[model samples]
Each structure stands twice: as C-alpha cells, then as structure tokens.
Target chain A: METQKTHILRRLFFSTLYLSAFTFGGGYVIVTLLKNRFVDQYHWIDEDEMLDLVAIAQSAPGAIAVNGAIVVGYKLAGLTGVAVSVLGAVIPPMAILTVVSYCYDAFSTNPYIAAMLGGMRAGVGAVITSVVYDMGKNVVRAGDPVNVVIMILSFCISYFLNVNVVFIIIAVAVFGALRSVAAQKAGERS
Target chain B: MICLRLFLSFMQIGCFCFGGGYAAMPLIEEQVVTANHWLTMNAFSDLVTIAEMTPGPIAINAATFVGTQVAGPAGAVAATCGYIFPSCLFVTLLAYVYTRFRNLSLIQQTLASLRPAVVALIAKAGIGILIAAFFVNGTFSLAAGNVSFRMILYFAAALVLLRKAKLNPILVMVLCGAAEVIFYCAGTLIR
Candidate 1:
C-alpha cells in the first residue's frame, strides 16, 4: 500500500511538472489540459467532478493552475500530494525566469523571440476561445435557464462593464445558494 | 530586508489575486512598479511580456523574476514561496470542504451554478488576450492599419487545427510560432 501511494505521488508530480512546463497560455489553458489528462486520459476523475474542481479553482484566490493542481492532487492522494504537485507546478517557471532575469537584455531585444511569442500569443488566444466554447456548451446543454442567463450576464458584466470577477462569482454563488434553499423547501412541502 | 519586503509584497499580491494570472497584473504593477520602484514601467512591461511568453502562472513568474532582480536566487525562492503559500492554505481547506460535502444538494447546486460563471470568466480572459493579439495596441479598432492580418491568419488557422483537426495544443502553438518565424524571414527577404 505504501509503495502504491508513493507511486501515485510520483506520477502526480511528473504529470504536473510536464503540464506546467508546456502550458504557455495561463490558467484556463492549464485547466483544460488538466481535464484532458486526468479525465480523458488517466480516467482518474469523471467529467462532472472535473467541472466542480474547476469551479472551485476559479472561485478561489490564486492562480487557477496551482489551485487546480492542489485540488486534483488532494483528490488523488492527500496533503502530501498537494505539496509534491505544487512543487512540480512551480519549478519550471521559477527556474526559467531566474535564468531570464540574469540575462534580460538578450531575451527582451531579440526580434525573432518576439515574433515567436507574438505568434504563440495568437495561438494561446485561440486555445482559450476554444475552452470557452466547450465549457459554455456544457452549461447550455444542462437545460438550466437560470444558468444560461447567468452565463450571459456574467460575460457581459465581465467583458463589457469590466466588473471584477470576484464580485461576479460571489454574486452567482449566493444566488445559487438561495435558489437551492428555496428548491429544498418546496420539495419538503410536496 | 529586501528579501523580506519582496516576500511580504508578493504575499499580499497572492492573497488578492482572484480569477487568474492576468487579473493579478494591476496588483503586481502596483507593488513592483509604483510602490517599490524596483523596476521602471518599461522594464515592468518587459517582465509581463516575458511572463506571458514563458510557461507558468504569470504571478509566479513575475514574483520569481522580480525577486531575483532585487536580490538573488534566495530572493526568488522567498518571493515564490510567499506567492504560493496562500494557495496551499486556501485550496487545501476548500478541497477538504468540497470533497466532504459535494454530495449534498446545496453544494452540488452551488457548484452547478458556478459552472456558467466560470465559463464567463474564461471567456472574458480569452477575449482580452485575443484583442491584444489581433490589435496593434491591445484594443479593439476596426481601422485597417490597426489590425494585424498575420495574427488573424494565425488565430484562424490555430482555431481550425484545434477545433477541427484536434491537434495537441502545445503542438499547435509550436507550429504557429514556426510559421511566424518563416513569415518574418520571408518578409525580410522581400525587403
């Protein structure tokens, strides 16, 4: 049992390390990648469960990538899993940035590097838009009118009005809680 | 003392960084550029570009880079630890609660409701990056001179590859970068 536990931890570490190293876009991209790996590939987690994990990650205060890693790790193992996963997630960027910081001049002024980054940013943008479409379709397919409306209003408030996301999350969560309570009470009455 | 200051400042940034890495930019700018004067605005912008270019959370990348600039390797460790500490604490507690009560209808419903909001958040972040990628100055402008057709082509091609062909995202990113480099070389040759 102990050996199996250690083996899982090791796998968790390497998976996060690989994902963190290669994921360039940011939180949502990493989250999508994580879902693909854990849910689609590893079969360690189910589709609905992954959505819940992502929602928790987004509502929390920190990088969604790290938060997703922590939660997924915890689900897989425990606190030790969290430590190993977080360490793996952090190392690559820290190491690369340290090197980049030492020789800032070379990296900043290289036109070729800039051009590549420019292209990568465009690619990252497309990847994120893909993620949005996938997740939005799932929400719409759930057949929840309230959820559909919330999704649209949340996007408008965030993209157009530029409202802080934290507020939107809190507002929707409270609305969900209140609605849940009302539903429960009605069910009890019936 | 410098390391301590870096750690504390980044700890504050970590505590307040909601949504994701991009949302943390203003808070980081406030701490690193305005309040501390550790880096000039131009350097800060450069740092952001580097952060976006690299593969990691922008907050973690920024903290490590700024910490190294202020002190050294130790400073990088300190700043990074500070930035990640809150996540460890908050996520563990939240995870425990979530796993314990997830079967409860209240929790389940709440999570269900959060799904669409989370989608919205991701959409907003994606559109922001998309605008930055396609526009000359990172804002929407229909003026022909302000749009980059090259980037739009790259974006459309990437979308097709990802959605239709179902290529690995990392592979798609590499292909786009390589294509851009070839375009750059060809343009120079034509000149």
Candidate 2:
C-alpha cells in the first residue's frame, strides 16, 4: 500500500506538472488534457468519474488545479494523493511564471505576442467547446432525455440568459436530489 | 500602502475563487475596476485578454501583471503568493482529513449528490463563455455578425481538429497563430 501510494503520487505530480508547464490558455484546458491522460490513457477512473472530478473542482472554492489535485488524490490515495498532486501542480507554474515575471515589462506589449494571442484565444474557446461536448456525452446519456434537455436549457441560460452559476447549480441539485428521492421511494413501494 | 493593498486584495480573490479564473472575472471586475478604481473596464478587459494568453490562471496572471505594473518584482511575488496561499493551505488540510475518512458512507453520499450539481455549473459556465465569446446584440449569430470571422473559423476548425485528428493542442495553437498573423497583416495591407 505504501509503495502504491508513492507510485500514484509520483505519476500525478508528473502529469499535473506537465499540464502546468504546457497549458497556456486556462485551467479548463488543463482539465481537458487531464481527462485525456488520466481517463483515456491511464484508465485511472474512467470518463464519468473524471467529469465528476471536474464538476466538483469547478464548484469548489479554489483554483481548478488545486481542486483537481485534492479530488483526484482522494480518489487515488485518499488524502496523500491530493496533497502531492496539488503541490505538484501549483509549485511549478508559480515558480516558472515568477521567473517570466522578469520579462513582463519588456515583452508584454510585443506585437508578435499580441498577434499570436489573438488567434490562440479563439482556439482556447474552441478547445473548451470540444471538451464540453465530450463531457456531455456521458453526463447526457440515452437513458435519460432529461439530461439532454437540462444541458441545452442550462447552456441557453448561461449563454443568452446570463444566469448566475450558483442559481443554476442549485436548480440542478434540487432536481437531481428530488429524482433520487423519488427513485428510492418507488424502489421501496415495489 | 498601494502594494500592501494589492497583495491583500489578490489574496481575497484567490481565496474565494470557485471554478477557474474566468469564473472569478466578475468579482475581479468588481474589486479592481469598480471598487479600487485602479483600472477602468477597458483596462481590466485588456488585462484579462493578456492574462488569458499567458500560462496560468487569470487570477495568478492578474496578480503578476498588476503587481509588476503597480510596484515591481517584489510586488509580483507578494501578490502571486498571496493569491496561491489559500488553496495550498486548504488542499493540504483537506487531503489529510480525507485520507482518514476514505471509507465514510456519508461522505460518499454527499459527494454523489454534489456531482450532478457540478455538471450543471460546468454546463452553465460553458454557456456563459460561449455567449460572451460569440453573442452580439443579445443574439448569437455567426452569419453577418460584427464579431470577427477569423475567431469563429478558428473556433470551429479547432473543434473539428481536436475531436477528429489526434493532433496536439499546442501544435494547433501554433499553426493557428501563424495563420492569424498572416491574415492580420493581409487585412491591414488591404485596408
């Protein structure tokens, strides 16, 4: 068990640090890559579990990487995994960026960087879109048409209606909870 | 005083940031643009734009950018560390407790309940970004819109490439960046 703990933490650290190093756009993009690596490549927890990790991480009060470290760690090695993973993710990015800090004044307004960023920004958005669609495949399953409708509605509310995240989350939680309760009662009845 | 204030303010942002950096933008707008009066909406928007292009959370990038702009290297360090401290502290402690409570049924039940709600938030957040990224005049239309056609094309193309091809995102971004610069120059020369 102890040897297993070391291996898991080691793998998580390297994976997250790689993400921190390469991820240029945002944390959401990192999450996508993470889902690919941990879920697709390693089969760490499968796709649904990975989506759940992202969801919980998103709703929690912290940086995305930190939340991921915690949740993935817990899933893998209880608490120790979370500790090492979060530390791994946070330290490298922070350190490297601080070094890059020395160049901010010189390079911040560079025309080339600015031009490249314009395209990269749009690409990041696209990546997010693709990731959401990928995640939706599982979250919105064929067994339930409600998941599909809820997803579409939520998307509209967020995009067009501009609803608060807290409100949307509360609505879904209440609905899912009620459904679970209803299912339990029906189970008892039968 | 200014440096100290920026440090503390960023710490607040970092501590309370749920989701990712983009999700924290509204609050950041409130604190930096509205409350502190350090920057206008335009400046904040520019900062966000630059932060998005960089390699970390916008919150961290904001701290580094603003800190450097406000003071210097020390300010940057102060603000970045302040922003990160809360999560580091929280995760370390939570991991410790979680290690001890791995098999607890109540915790399992609570986590299960929380998962779907999380999906809603993720979906909602995606919509919000999509709307902001694409919508114009309270309606979303890719045709005959004021929004940049290049951006939309990149978005659509990248989505297809990502889903279909086994290409690296970094490589895609690099190729797209080169194309954008070429197109930008061509547009400028034509105009």
- DockQ, candidate no. 1: 0.48
lDDT of 2 at B7: 75
Q: Which residue pairs show collisions in model 2?
A: A73-A82
**How displaced is residue B122 in candidate 2, in Å?**
5.0
Candidate 2, A1-190: lDDT as tens digits = 8787688789988887788777776677778888888888888888976776666565455678657766776777765676677667766555655655566446547876556655665565665556556666766554567666666675566546666544654576567667667766788899
Model 1 bad stretches (over 4 Å): A1-85, A100-105, B1-79, B94-105
Best by TM-score: 1
Candidate 1 per-residue lDDT over residues A38-70, each given as its tens digit: 999989999999998887777667898999999
Output the lDDT of residue B46, model 1.
54
The 10 consecutive residues of candidate 2 chain B with the worst lDDT sum are B102-111
| Per-residue C-alpha lDDT of model 2 across residues B68-180, encoded as one tens digit per residue | 66777777767776776676666555545545653333333333444434454455444434444444332356566756766678778877787789566666656666777
